[model samples]
Target: MSSPRKTSPGKRMTAGLLVMAGLLLVREFAPESPIAIAALIIGLIALLIIIPAYFRALLSSRRDR
Candidate 1:
């Protein structure tokens, strides 16, 4: 008998939310300063990369089950 698969919805949601929050924080902190803008850009890049990866992993895990 195979064990039931685990769906980490909470983890996925938390990660996505955290990344979004970080992005918001970066934007709010340095809306005009060049360094803040750079950080915001970097945060956006990271968010673009991370959120999808997290969702993909979550979906793959669910599919595997």
Candidate 2:
């Protein structure tokens, strides 16, 4: 039997750190730039859309189990 593949906590942490670093570099290059503002707004919008879906999925999965 094969086990399910899973991401380790360390891998998740590293990926998060890399993403944060990239965002910091972008901000450093263009502090107060329109692209940065737009990026921020888009990210906020994505979060607003995704978070509700994420919670719904979590609740549904829990209910299934």
Candidate 3:
């Protein structure tokens, strides 16, 4: 049996930020459209989820050192 690879939270956070940036760029092209609104909501939710996890992971890693 193989152990699953662990992904660090910072990397996850970076990916989430990249996705949010992409969504923002897309939204700029269609500022009042439904798709833009949905993208904004999704990006906000992603930041809400990932930012906390990243901070928690950062603190835990420091304690392990």
Candidate 4:
């Protein structure tokens, strides 16, 4: 049997996606609410943060091999 490996970036990206989905649902119910806008902004920020972090990890791992 083989153990499965975990990835931090993958998890972060998945979390970002889930947050965005939740924000979309909120927007559908209350499009003009401040809370919906706030949730959207936070979700975008989380998604943006993951991009560079993922690339950096990929580049560093390549250099090691």
lDDT of each: 0.71, 0.61, 0.87, 0.76
lDDT for model 4 comes to: 0.76
Error of 2 at 24 (Å): 6.8
Locate the minimum summed-lDDT window of 10 residues in model 1: 7-16
Stretches off by above 4 angstroms in model 2 are 1-28
Using lDDT as the measure, what is the rank order of every candidate, best first?
A: 3, 4, 1, 2
TM-score of 3: 0.78
- Kindly list the per-residue Cα lDDT of model 4 for residues 1-65, writing each as its tens digit: 99998666657666767777887888889888898889778877977967766776688678879
Which residue window of length 10 is worst by lDDT in model 3? 6-15
TM-score per model over all chains: 0.49, 0.52, 0.78, 0.59
How far is 58's C-alpha from truth in model 4 (Å)?
5.7
Error of 1 at 17 (Å): 10
Q: How far off is model 3, as Cα RMSD? A: 1.7
Judged by whole-model lDDT over C-alpha atoms, candidate 3 comes out at 0.87
Better of 1 and 4 by lDDT: 4
Report model 4's TM-score to 2 decimal places: 0.59
lDDT of 1 by residue, 1-65 (tens): 99998656556556756776876887787688786767767667767766776777778889989
Best by lDDT: 3
Error of 4 at 6 (Å): 9.5
